[model samples]
Target chain A: MISLFLDTSSKKLVVILVKDKEIIGKKELESINDHSSYLVPFIKELLDLNNIKTNDINKIFVVNGPGSFTGTRIGVTVGKVLAFSNNIPVIPVSSLKQYIFSLENYDYYVSIIKDKNNRMYYGIYDKDYNDIVVDKYQTKDVFLKDINDLKNVVFISEEEIDGIDTIKPILNINKLIDYYKDKEINAHYLKPNYLKKIDAEDKL
Target chain B: MNEYKLTTRCEEDTISIAENLEAEKFPGMVICLNGELGSGKTVFTKGFAAALGISETITSPTFNIIKEYLNGEMPLYHMDIYRLEDNPESTGLLDYFDKDGVVIIEWANMIEDYLPEERLDVYFKVIEEDKRIIKFIPHGQKYEELCEDAL
Candidate 1:
């Protein structure tokens, strides 16, 4: 069985192709404000490079936000369209979860994505990647205070944070697929998890 | 008053400072913001609001003068005094100082006379598109401690 992975929640666009638990091909592109224009073509190229056609993909996995609004939408939309058209199962993964899955063995894991104005999209997971803390937007100070006394904790983020032991996360597609194997949802129900409300939706 | 200066190379640094400030937020706390347009006054307020547990989107209350958000850990009084340059005195505005909420006033220099004597004043200077020089002036011991805790 062939599986496809797409991640466009950040400035980076990452695509991965896996055949029976083995990664056949992977491609990453770092571009700002250009996800919509490049995502489809990139995915097509990645599939072509691996000698796999779109119809051969049995399942699709996508990082469904807590990052850029437009980027998340573009990735999710592509994933949904591809999955629905091919009648394949699609798994929507959280960017924070992906970050945690990419980490090594640790007692406690904190994954963060810096949003506008110092607010962070953060998640805390246990050794088995279970949620010890829920995903939400918080100031760096509040987040630090929450985890300040924690023992054997490791932090993963794309940006350098002060007063904490932090490292950049290395995304692992195979781990993500293995972790979310049975949690596939209908493509229609898949939506971006933007913890922070957009400006247009603020006035309710 | 004791003054502290910090130069931020990007918006993330400014937000980190704001988040640290939010960790030390208290009732009746007043933060006066002074900076030119696009100097990140609203960005600082957004960081503070998120720390207070506000999930709602925060925008500059430029047209409304004062927008109150009570959904957070404590009430947040976000005010933009830019439009009040000519007439800074409004009776309702005085009520906010003692509302037992965290009040952050942007373009606060316009309404200097009406401000409390004991407050934290922050002045932002745009050094580059993403760089900023932020000056913190703490007028009281409590505010000084707040600066120490946050910065």
Candidate 2:
């Protein structure tokens, strides 16, 4: 079975194709802010380069973000469209947790994706792989109030990778593929686990 | 009030030096980048962002006051205080400083009081064509350690 992953959360467009725990093909264009103009063609090119027809792809994985709101929407929309058309299942992974999978070994990881409203998509994961949201996606005050003393917190994100005294925000897409493969889980709708609350409240 | 001097070729080179320094510096630390306009302050910031693994484009936050990049392995908060000339005591800008991330401030000289006393202060001065004199000063123990590491 073959799987295709698309990560268009920020300035970069990351696309990867995997088969049986190996990366068959991959392409990354850094700082491509024009998501709408470039994403579709990038995917088409990836499929063509691999010589794999869209129908040949068994599953599709996409990093549903807590990232550039527009970028997240475009990437997810494309992933959904492709999956639906090809009759393939879609695995919507959190762009933030994708950071956790990226950083291989650490006692604990604190992943912070960008929140344009001046906040972050923050979470924690222990060495045991048990994840915890210290402060769910919220702005600066909430993040600071929740995490007062920074001890054993390895903040990870794709942006501002230098500021945190902890780990880097490099997302490892291969680990994610291997994870799903071992679990025998084919493509599924893995929604983005963003902790952000939409301002619009439901009917009272 | 304290100072350490170093030579750099260009703006990006300044960032590379800052990046290497930040890689070994302490967290929960506040480092200020102070310089005159066009003195390569923002360029140095780009290098620091690169060190943090931020692959996104880095530019001066002169108008925005703060721009955070999370595209790499760490969180980088880029702040420009040039706009603070209007109101140094404004609440929103100060609040930005209170966020959780590594912050690099341009025109830090404009809003001195808004900054933490215990911070890293980098001073940039243009010497001649394509030459800059950069100084790193640590305010407290943490910043001092940062200065040592940056050295």
Candidate 3:
């Protein structure tokens, strides 16, 4: 079975094609401004590079986000369209969850994405992969105040925050596919995971 | 909302007012400047950036949309929202406010709905040649104190 993983929730764009337990073709680039333009072409390039056809993709792993509003939409939309058209199982992975997917040794892991002024999408996961602290959009101040009381907490994020030494998350498509294989949703039900409400969405 | 008024007899007076505000500057300070063209809006911004020790020639960000000066005492995110009035994309704009920088938005009234609840607004009114009436309306407690100290 062939698995395709796509993450475009931030400045970094990741496209990985995994065959069985091994990752075959992976492309990670900083396609800063335009995610929509780069996503499909990169998918096609990875498939062509691996000598696989579009119909060979059996499953799709898409990072739905509490991230850049436009970037999140582009990724989720593409994932939905591909899954629907090709009859593949699409799994919606949390961008925050992806930050700590590989850090199971730690008793606790804190994943945060700074979304706006002093506001962030924060989640805490236990060694069992349970969301000990339910994912929510809140001020960094609130998270810091609560974290002061915890022990052996590892912070994972894309940006290096002050005072808190953060571990940069490395996306491993093979590991991610193996872990979230059963968490599949119908493509029609997939939507951008915006933890906070957007101004335009409110108007609609 | 707290409001104050000031009159600048010349461009130097406007510069001094900006300098006084700079004295009270802090990280994440949001200042909104509004006025007609050549109404000393750019003059005030140049004065503020100069006071922040930004030596690079300050040009209006009208064409660039947003100009970032990171070498200053604190980062200065100079933005022109006039062109972005009709644009619906505002994803990364609010992120600058948390960069621990002073965000100065020109033609700020264009996106008043998106502005932070805590900010200072400066309105420039042309009264006569070489003279301008500047009105300061501050929101939130910190901005109210900023006007009390600077205006």
Name the candidate that leads on DockQ: 3
Order by TM-score, highest first: 3, 1, 2
Give interface RMSD, every candidate, in order.
16.1, 10.9, 4.9
Order the candidate numbers by lDDT, best to worst: 1, 3, 2
Fraction of the native A-B contacts that model 1 recovers: 0.00
For B1-151, candidate 3 gives per-residue lDDT tens digits of 6679899999999999999999999988999999999999889989999999999988999988889998889889999887775443444675566557899999998887668878999999999999999999998889999888887
TM-score of each: 0.57, 0.50, 0.66
For model 3, how does the per-residue alpha-carbon lDDT over A65-128 read when each residue is reduced to its tens digit?
A: 8676777888899999999999999999888888676776887889887654466787888776
Error of 2 at A23 (Å): 1.7
Candidate 1 C-alpha error for residue A14, in Å:
0.8
DockQ of each: 0.03, 0.03, 0.14
Across B28-139, the per-residue lDDT of candidate 2 in tens digits comes to 4567888788888877777777777777888779888778786755567778877765564323344344345677778787777457667788888889878999888888
Decreasing DockQ order of the candidates: 3, 1, 2
Model 3, which residues run further than 4 Å from truth?
A197-204, B1-31, B36-122, B129-151
Which stretches in model 2 have alpha-carbon errors above 4 Å?
Answer: A114-118, A145-153, A159-164, A180-204, B1-151
- Give the alpha carbon lDDT tens digit for every residue of B1-151 in model 1: 6789999987788888999999998988999999999998998899889889999999999988899999999899999987764454322475467467899999888888668778999999999999999999998888999998888
DockQ of candidate 3? 0.14
Q: Where does model 1 exceed 4 Å of error? A: A197-204, B1-151
Backbone clashes in candidate 2 total: 22
DockQ preference between candidates 1 and 3, better one: 3
